[model samples]
Target: MARTRTLLTAGAFALVTALLPTITTVGAAAADRDGPGPVAVSESRGQLTVTVPPGHGGPGYRLLIDEKTLGVRTVRAGRTVLATNPAGGFAFGDQHATSVTTWSYAAGTLRIAAASTAPADTVAVAITPTADRYDLTWSVAGAPAGARTVSYQLSSAGHWYGGGETSEGAAQPYPLDAGQVSEPDFSPASYLMMEPYWYTSSSVGNYVRTASPMDVQINKSASGLGDFTIKSTDSYASTVFVESTPSAVYQDYVEVVGKPSKSDATPAEIAQPLWNSWAQFYTAIDQNKVLDWAGKLHAAGLGGHTIQLDDKWESNYGNLTFDPKTFPNPKAMSDQIHSMGYHFGLWTTLWINLDSANYAYAKDHGYLLAAAADSTKPCTVTWWNGTAGIIDLGKPAARDWYTGNLHQLMSTYGVDGFKFDTRFFDDSCAPAAGVQAGDYQRLGAEMADGFDLQGAGVRVHWGNQKYGFVIRAVDAGTSFPELRTTLRRSMAISTDGYPFVETDMIGGSLGEPAPTKQVLVRWAQAASLMPLMYSSTSPLGVVDHTTGKPVTYDPETVQLYKNAIARHGRLSDYLQAQARKSVADGTPIIRPVFFDFAADQRFYTTDDEWMLGPSVLAAPVLSDSPTRTIDLPAGAWFDTVTHRVITGPRTLSAYPAPLGVTPAFVRLGAPGAATAIAALSHQS
Candidate 1:
């Protein structure tokens, strides 16, 4: 039966190959060459075919497959089978370009070799197919003279359609620019040539413009999805150029289908109650001390949602065992927190300590990435847990083992969610030497997959840049639904359409001093519109290193934070409802100034002012100056603080902005409203 099944699969493959003209033989023998150089045409699984033109001069050869021109490459006569960029691109002189190459077969591989008369320059390129994507590897014989960079363009077809690039290497749906015009006929092919810088600027400044018509439109009526069609153009053939430089343009396009309904539960929603913390809860304050703080917050009307027992709960950093002395009875403590109306959250990174019991198992099983003998060597950097090694999440058994341990922690501690941190560190530290380059890419994808399969809502911190190939897997909306932090401009951009987008309350990192009264008000006013909000303060009360003093909040500053928290709590239901609408309909909580003032060209470049939903416009005083001039599009706006009505398309006169005030206004008749000012104050 087994033999028959194998034969049946082989026969099925053969049948498919016969029907598909693109399928070529794998590992076929090379033909003889009589000219100055060998011009070989090789096909792989029929989906991709490589043809090296005769007398291939210069340092490399060009790749043409499946009627699509992939990129140009440097070739060597012998010694190396393939030489190409780990990241894809074409380089001319010193310039690097962005582009994409599409593969046909759902699962297959391709390799191309070239022989050149130039002994100094040799190159080989290899392509391997996965279930959903392709892996490319390139090798060069000797280093090239002068600077080299890769330049290329991708065909926006299938899932490779319209999207924006992030400094983190993932492509996300571009935000809708109200006044900004998209080219007509802006299909995927037309916009695909518009190369947005992958890991630097998130704006359209890096895109390419052509004489041909470009047809593309951003779909925000539903969840943020980009649908585009590229009309065939006669001017330029669909080609990807490769050059050598700072890096290669390795492009990854993800086919993400938006949620059908806005009310659908996000990973954060499902995992909110499961949220746990490290030993920070106890270490920040003693058991009695935290109980007192928790009681105070409860009394202050500040409800505790989740009190995560951070790192200190463990016996040691690397040892996953509980610190019996500190935790005493963790179950009792967990029950106490629950009784106080808060869930539990825990933190764990992938690094394991040599002293831990799991260390022997990991070392013996070939899971640890460090030598047991030398702990001083920077196996991975020295983490919180002294002398730790990263666990190989790439291996199936290793992943299973890690998952089982996590499950054990949850079951034993009655924990809600796991704050999975540093899983990406695996990219830098592989368990074994000589691992294939493709294997490295696969490792990131596998780790993301493993986290999803583990059945726990994983919370990912920053570090999206390391695994450049994995889109949104970091912030990609796959592994984590809610992000930990949303920096200033990031909040404005990401919240444009993404639902469940949360930002830190009032102040971001607890280590920094709390915001001034005015800054606090502005931040709170902005945060109130977001789906998720929290107040995070450093428990250590240590002075900031840069400022060199413990952060002391003035009475006014404290009052403002308290007031904002109180207001947010009072309006939580309404705000959450709006957030639900946003999640459901792709409406942004924190809209850009341009969205509301689309017709006004002046607001296109303005980043300081933004709309907090449809009803309110928040113009924060970012500069240290006493007053700032604001550009308001034609509209009747009423000041929330003073109830003063001001007409649009005019500059508002100077107003006293001493440390406590922000120039914010509410739109006259926009729906879904909330304001710091009373309605009667805005009477006609």
Candidate 2:
């Protein structure tokens, strides 16, 4: 007679069996001496199981669920199973993709079932660990059409298990170790992959789950590839889901706080110009020329809270010394700027030039990172003026020396804040000796922490992307609370894209034409909602690099930017309050569609439209057309421009987007402040 089912029972064992019509059992003679010769097949209820023959090789074992084979592990000593990474799975053909791992069972079977949404399509796997007898299910959906297959492999002596497509034959395997770290390539066109390994020892009591922390490498392939990576660690304990698709989210605010006040007791009066450098620029063009611009800005009610002396305000970029011959009295420039109701702001970078007086000072202290062991690789890199070398922030002595100089300038010269620039380029320095790639994050964090300690009250002007790495520099009142926790290095989207605090170069760098009227209008409307906003028109207001400078500004463009800035200033009180609330609640002032309409299918893939705050919905036209169409969310919305009311969940066409207008609306009954920012009319 054909062999029937044979039960192996032990005290306190949790047994779950799935029986199928094709059930078959092996007799005692076929059982191996070591164990049950690795049960080839077992099934009961909805569960299925298969064990690999010990020491078996090739491409690990495969589990045929619904006739679709999913890869499993084949180990020599004991059985090993593969599971998906919680974050996501890797892309099949693209190096930028992410991946996930599956869970294994001690003595029980696992079940694969069809997803509720997609019938007949097995979209989930359930693993039952006999040790805990806990059934945990991992659902898989949202797999792009590109990833059609998933396979796994095991090598003889390598601790790294390889994973790839059976048909593709190319595998990217990561080593399994306690402290092993790798930056895995991730891109919009690829998928994310993750694998989990668990060690179970009878001598060690219970099974311990182990996973490798992978840094998702984003934007590594192409410049415009709209993809970003997120770092993952084994400490993460949460259910992971693959969202439909990802888009960028922007949040953060900028505030200019150097405006002078009429009363000496006011907040503005207490703030003073921290540094003076106007003499360097004024020496070229007489003192009268320098004062003329200051008077014009004051007369036009446009004097910045802090008067920034741009490049050339210094004798040299690398030289931190003052040019006494030019200024005669450096203190007078600071007093003049302060008397005119503005704090003085200066620009500086980390470079130390050979020609500068500080170069010898820095060299004597051994502050710079030497390129060669001989200390003579010439710490040089090209910048604005000429060749220079950067002071290594990673070293404590260097940080102390740099901070001491800055502190002296702040305390002695009354300098309020430093406009730091150009420290992001990593290629400039030869990798420091004894520095490893994993130490990058900690080193950056340490530098930021040091800056925070030194410049306790002073504000640091930071670039948008740099903010992700050194957020600790933002002072208490300066930082938006909501952005603190979410600022990661490689987010899915651009952090600077939103109208936030770090002054965004208005038209963007690279000498692109000033944003089109539509871009400006949208930017203006969005900016109006930020804590701080400023217009960074190209130097001399000329943007086209090809044309040498008969700089002509459109009267309309000037009026629009002027109006936008003034309007932003006028609503500063309200915007500041909103920003404070956003920080307190950990919600962004600029929210994407999914935030407000998560369950709404219509807004799932929408990127162009976003909410400025809780009440206002801004749909800025990205195209050049004077009029554009906008889709509104559900409920009634009051037109911010026309005051015309309309119901949402519908698209409105031919919305006017003239040079100064942005197609914006406020939800009806929502509390918000909307003020027109048109130039004042002078009627005779």
Top candidate (TM-score): 2
lDDT of 1 by residue, 1-684 (tens): 000011124456558557654433322222212124333344333223443333321222334442112343322232122222323342322332222222222123344432223334433445542221223444344534332222322111111211232223222322233212243432221201122222111111112222223344333343222222222321211222221210111221101122213332233332222222211132443455445545554454444356654455567665666776766677776677778776666667677766777777776786655433453332454654476766665466766777787777778877665444454333234344544322432354345443321112222212112221111112211111112113332443333223344443333333333334444444544444344444334222223333555554455554544454444455445455555555454455555555556456565445556666676676645444567777777888887657678888877656655444556677877774543344213211
What's the number of clashes in each of the models?
A: 73, 52
Candidate 1 — which residues are off by over 4 angstroms?
A: 1-289, 366-387, 430-486, 492-499, 504-526, 538-558, 570-574, 581-588, 596-599, 621-628, 656-663, 668-684
What is each predicted model's overall lDDT from 0 to 1?
A: 0.40, 0.37
Error of 1 at 481 (Å): 28
Q: In model 2, what is the error at residue 193, expressed in angstroms? A: 24
Candidate number with greatest lDDT: 1
Report how far off residue 176 is in candidate 2 (Å).
30
